[model samples]
Target: MLETTETATDPKRARILDGALKMFLAYGFSRTTMDDIARAAEVSRPALYLLFKNKTDIYRALASVVFEESIAKARAELAGDAPLGERLFQVIDTALISVMAKIAESPHGAEILDMKGSLAGDVVEGWRAAMVGQFTAAIGEEARATGVDLAARDLSPVMLADVLFDGLEGMKMRVSGAEEQRKAVRGLVKMVELAIRP
Candidate 1:
């Protein structure tokens, strides 16, 4: 039996994806066309179609990659042997700061902001859920360490996590400048620290 190799093996496909991402980031889902992506990538329209089904598909692919990358970074940041409080703060601070930096550097920062309500909505929400769940689990672990019975708690981990995640997202959307973004995120980091304190 012959093994199937990856079709994306061609450098041309990678170029198309890279170019498409830039175009999508520049023009957004509603404005970008396959032709624009092909032109930017220096590939034929037919070639672009072969690589991606449509603009939505390309955006989904890019969003998935971005989401997974952010999640991995947050998880790695939380993997330290530091105290639970410090680990949680590191994860929130590092991940939010990285996300803000990416948005600030993008040419279509406003377009990127609108992506949360598009088809990529699921990707964004899914990532948020995973991040919050991780934080909640960490909190529960800390509670156990402190001899507190989480079972008798009035506040569930999910509730607490949702509040923190929503607050972080709100803060991220409100900041316009890089300095403001940094300040807003630091404030959020401090809020999370206060909230998680025993």
Candidate 2:
């Protein structure tokens, strides 16, 4: 587990994270340095150290904040007045595809993604759980609102949510770029609409 000096929401901490993310995306996680972050953040190296133990800690904080924002966006999108398919599409778009596509566009995207395997296991796991929960809630709420008894089709909220998550994750691997990802997500949304539509 990683240790942190302060929450990412702290004004100073947020400034540090913004700089750290810029450095990481611009230079890649394996190549970015704490000094780079401090310079970009306009903090002395020692002052930056006072808030974050290292660059990786700052990176983890950014990931946490991004996850939180994504989940909140997804939840709000699900609760919107859009039609079911559009709402569901927005949920996945906001939560999954948006960040993934942003990273994939970065010059060091692959390297940064590889860092996730070694440095961000816990944060990544938490993100996955939260994303799945958001999907499950949205699906269940839609089902109830539309009087779709998923149990009659041998499906539960958890089941459909798991399938959606797994399918989207797989789709990421299969696609090459952001545009393809958006199109694929819509196809998945259409399939989901068919399953639970009234």
Candidate 3:
């Protein structure tokens, strides 16, 4: 009974999110209305309203799913009983680049970049902060496992994570061109290794 219920709900929600993502990527948040999402999803506007209160709610749910999945993947990459440097590089190569590429290739990638001015809401900012926090927490755990003395280190976990995420965001643009993402990723992995060296 539970499985059937979830199976039914999951597809409908996914359908909505898929449609919204396309439209949001194309026209952006503010410009893409609920009516647009309904038409794109092939559902009635009333149905969309029943599923989501408004654009903000739908965006929050969608962003949460993406962010949570990325964080979980990073955690899994770092969970292996390997050297800290090895695990960190794996996390960067597999998890971070995966998320970055998804964003880069996504039609909504640029729209998402312009989200704040378009949505002009706190939910977006909150999600951005949450992503940073998750990254910082993961890095701190990795540093501890590696036996790095935090007090002696020049970089705080928060600062390190911030730089890492920001650096990737910048790289996503530069590397996304001419299929240079792979080369860019390699450069990033080397940069991380150099930064974490004892």
Candidate 4:
């Protein structure tokens, strides 16, 4: 069943999503049944079904929660008075690297990546688009604050944002641990500093 408007704001629905996320991460999505989610959430099968129709629905909702929370946190960092490089680093960490790390660390990562006839993939794509938009806006703000016309340097805010995000995607593939991710963030911050500095 499709999600109802009230589902988004329902406390019980949030509980279900939380429980589902934990279960899905612990046991791969393929192994997590609706019964497991109901038990984890401490709800009856019928009650759980009232909130979400199936495992796929729960998974989609969980993915949406993660995506939205990350975007909100990233936007807060971006709007802060921190220096441009610092803000950019926080944005990348919250918006991109953390989500990638979560998936990589999960047993169901591959299944989530390859899931067919599911909305999980679409949720991730939407998250990426939102990240790009946040990054582009933050870059534009930085450019304006620094009086650096990105267009004058053969670039635009959107292009710079896309480049940084694309670079982070590549970095996420190669990094083996949190330390490596931190180093990658540093590298990205340096790149942005050099690109935007007068």
Candidate 5:
């Protein structure tokens, strides 16, 4: 569950976060200010302060929404009754490829998405751990169902999840475009399916 500093559903709060996202993407996080967010949001500066402590607070809130939605969508995909490889592909598409593609289309998007030196690093880390845990559980269940002897293979579900997560992150960093990413994820998913085949 997302522990956002502010509730995301409130219209005013949503407006603030959405407006902040636009400002941050347009100007980069370092250059975006509370005034800019307030102006963009159509809220008074004092009203913005009432909702968020400052620029970092808005950034963190915005990040929480993004990460929460990404994980939620990925989890929903995994919960479907698709084959293991298809499910994994859905997870990757929702969590990384689709999200990254949207961000890539925005101005200064990468700068805003950069978690380093940001107050929301913990938020990003939490999301990562959650994804790893989800993948580990899913992979363990699949292995059991398929009668794959992970012990004989010298692999554990967590280790498998770690490798998969690393590869997914690498793709996010190295893949240049949406179509390329889709192809890369397909190849990775195929490899995972082969590795786990009964």
Candidate 6:
């Protein structure tokens, strides 16, 4: 079982997580031990142990922070009064591109892509489910506001959100730079606009 103690409010835990992320990105998960984290965090080994049990525990905490921050930003964008295209673009950039780019920009990018040999897979899946739920709800709200009935076209808001999310994920993988990704996202948003136009 993983430790679930609240660490977001604890400054020391946050510092530990920050240090661990940097170490993991720099040295890969296998090579980053508790001692390495302690040194990077400038915390004693005893202090680090009091906060986290092991490297995996620290990794889980770091993952939690990343997903939580990303989702919060995405939710904020969705709740904004901006036009649907701009809002949706911001959601894609926040939820998917930004998260993936963080790992890809790291020195141990390939290893991080493997997600510590599936140690973080469950965490990622949970984040994805939550994100999809949020996206679906946001889409439903927007559609109702615009009087666009997706059901008439054999589509639900959830289905549309899933399609858009998957499309963005694919596009992010294909594109390299931030500018290219933004262009791809804009193109996708345009297609979405055309698809739902009354």
Report each candidate's C-alpha RMSD, comma-separated, in the order given.
4.9, 3.5, 4.7, 3.6, 2.6, 3.4
Q: All candidates' lDDT scores?
A: 0.69, 0.80, 0.67, 0.78, 0.81, 0.79
Error of 3 at 158 (Å): 3.2
**For candidate 5, lDDT tens digit of each residue in 39-111?**
9999999999998998888887777787778788778888889998899888888777777677777888777
Clashing pairs in 1: none
Sort by TM-score, top down from the best: 5, 2, 6, 4, 1, 3
Relative to the true structure, candidate 1 reaches a TM of: 0.78
What TM-score does each of the candidates earn?
A: 0.78, 0.90, 0.67, 0.87, 0.90, 0.88
* lDDT digits (tens) for residues 115-195 of candidate 1: 656768888889888899788877666666666654565665566677777877777667666567666656655565555
Residue 103 of model 4: what lDDT?
A: 71
Clashes of 4: 0
lDDT of 3 by residue, 1-198 (tens): 112233256877777888887788788777899999998888998889998999987787666566556556666766678765566566666655665555656666766756643554565556457656766776677667677765586777788767766776687656655246556655665565555565
TM-score of candidate 3 to 2 decimals? 0.67
**Segments in model 4 whose C-alpha atoms lie over 4 Å from true places:** 1-8, 99-103, 106-119
Off by over 4 Å in 2: 1-9
Candidate 4, 32-146: lDDT as tens digits: 9999999988899999988788998877777777677788878899889989889888877776667667776777776764562355877878888898898889888888988
Identify the candidate with maximal lDDT. Answer: 5
Tens digit per residue, CA lDDT, model 6, 98-183: 76787878888667667733777788878888888887887788778788899888988788778877887688568887778988
lDDT of 2 at 138: 77
Clashing pairs in 3: 25-108
TM-score of structure candidate 6: 0.88
RMSD of 4: 3.6
